[model samples]
Target: MLSLSFLCVIAFFAGLVDAAVGGGGLIQIPGLFSALPNVAPATVFGTNKLASAVGTLSAARSYLRRVRLPWRLVLPTTVAAFVFSFVGAQVVSLIPKGVIRPTVLVLLVIMAAYTLWKKDFGKLHKPVEIGRREMAIGLAIGCAIGFYDGLFGPGTGSFLMFLFIRFFAFDFLHASAAAKVVNLTTNVAALLSFAIGGHVLLAYALPMAAANMAGAMVGTRLAMKKGAGFVRVLFLLLTSVLICKLGWDLLQG
Candidate 1:
């Protein structure tokens, strides 16, 4: 019971961070492992997804209300992500994640460094590019990141945000909003697999979901109010943290 309480607290803050930017796993996953050491990794992952899905769903709705999302791109990309994520989840056991870690860490480092160096990168909305070419890029990014989400399950949201900004030429605020939709699609796909496999801890997930929803609402409101500048800073910070976390994991292994 005490441990469950701790997990809830962790979920609350994780939801806040995730809603503000997109690195909830950094907080939620480690807490789950520390709190329930005996639980299988798959179960812990499943429970974390369950909690995060609720949070992302809430955030998505909030963004939809305030932000004008590129549905033409988001809708198709989300569909691709949904299908590919299921495939990725099914084949997760066959893949060796060792090779992917270094590549992912390098990419994250580049993303963080580039964002930091470019002071006015996402400060304003300047989507000078759009149409079929952009849609194609969005689909490709969604497929690639969705596969990563299902197979490895870390830094998915940050990757989505980065891709949206880079490929679609969206500002940070709009990119983050779109990323939530894609992230939610991937999360739902992963969650279904986990739930079917009986890996989720429902007892903890329910309360965590409630807390996550609250946090998402608050975070989305703040992002909408503060605009792209705030989101850009948060996104860079989250990417830096992800780089460090992945770098540490690679070193430890």
Candidate 2:
């Protein structure tokens, strides 16, 4: 097993990355696998969720204090994400994620390419006009992304932010804030699923969670200071990284 310090360091960075762009699992999951290769994969995943959920909770709260969260999306998306994530987790074992991985890779690639090409995208912060159809679309995005979080388990935050920009016309800062709320709901639901199955390792999760929370606070502050433009850049960078990461996973599979 890796030392406590090593684990905390990993969690800290994981929280930072996640708070910035919603791909914190990209770091924490691999770190956990490396640290506890002998442990059951489920336990490692659960532990990662616990630590990340705490960090997300902190980031979400921090964001709310500074930014006005889009309740229109949160009201529909948060509930849908929570319920569908649980459903996704329940069905994950029956699904072949390897088959799903390639499809996700293609989507991520397209998303990254489009975002990179669009210079003014996510730069303007304006509230969208929400009608009944808009509300349904928001809920659909939440449920679909939430289900994907449970079934495939990567890039959930990035997807949320991207969809918010693409569909709802939210800027990066607002999108990131809204995404955190949705991400936290999905993370908690998934964590509960693992906990019920007796997969979480609290011994490691608790300590790492402390570090993750701290990292989240720091990241939240940085993102706030940098504004939507900085977040736009970071979002694109992280999406590209996710593309490569999933592509590599597909190749390995």
Candidate 3:
């Protein structure tokens, strides 16, 4: 009961953070490992996905209802993300965690530094016209990041948020909102695989999913009220934490 309670609390915070700036796995993944040390890693990961998918879907729905996204871009991006994420999962064993972690850590540091350096980054919304060029760019980003999410599975949301802001000229708020949709798609794809593999633990996932949805609602409200600058700050903070966490893991390994 205590362990379940702890996981529920973690899921709530994870949803809150994820709904704001994307990095819920930073919170929930470690919590699962610590709480269920005796469980198989695949099961823990699957349960995490189940709970996270619900929270992300909740956040995505909230954003979709309130924010006006470019569906022209969103559709292709989502399809590409779902397909590539599954492909990445199929070949996950071909790559090694050691190789991926350090590379991701470096990318996070670079992304963080660039964001810090550009004071006006993600501050304004200047969406590009939907054209062949933009569509191609969106597809490329979806393929790369989707594969990364399936293969290594950290900072997927942050990466998507950054790319949306940097490439699409979306403000932090819009970027975060759009990222939720893509993130939710990836989570659902991964969750289906886990469910098929019998790795998901519904007893824990259902409760955590409920807590996560509630947190996502609260978080979406906060972001909508606070606006883009607030989300930019959150993006930086969460990315920094991810950087530090990945750094620590690499060092330990």
In terms of TM-score, the best-performing candidate is 3
Error of 3 at 83 (Å): 0.5
lDDT for residue 133 in candidate 2, whole number 0-100:
81
Models 1 onward score TM values of 0.96, 0.97, 0.98
Clash-forming residue pairs, model 2: none
Per-residue lDDT value at 65 in model 3: 93
Candidate 2: lDDT over CA atoms? Answer: 0.90
Clashing pairs in 1: none
Q: How accurate is candidate 1 locally (lDDT)?
A: 0.87
- Alpha carbon lDDT of each predicted model: 0.87, 0.90, 0.91
Model 1: CA > 4 A from native: none
Task: Kindly list the per-residue Cα lDDT of model 2 for residues 1-253, writing each as its tens digit.
Answer: 4566788999999998789788999899888888887999989999999999999999999999998866865789899999999999999999888788888989888898888889888999776788888899989988999999987778899999999999888899989999999999999999999999999999999999999999999899989999999998888888888888877777787
Question: Which has the better lDDT: candidate 2, or candidate 3?
Answer: 3
Cα lDDT tens digits, model 1, 1-253, are: 9998898888888888888788888999999999999999999999999999999999999998888976888998999898889889999999888988999998888888878888877777777556898888878987898888888877888888877877667888888899899999999999999999999999988888887888788888888888889888888788878888888888899
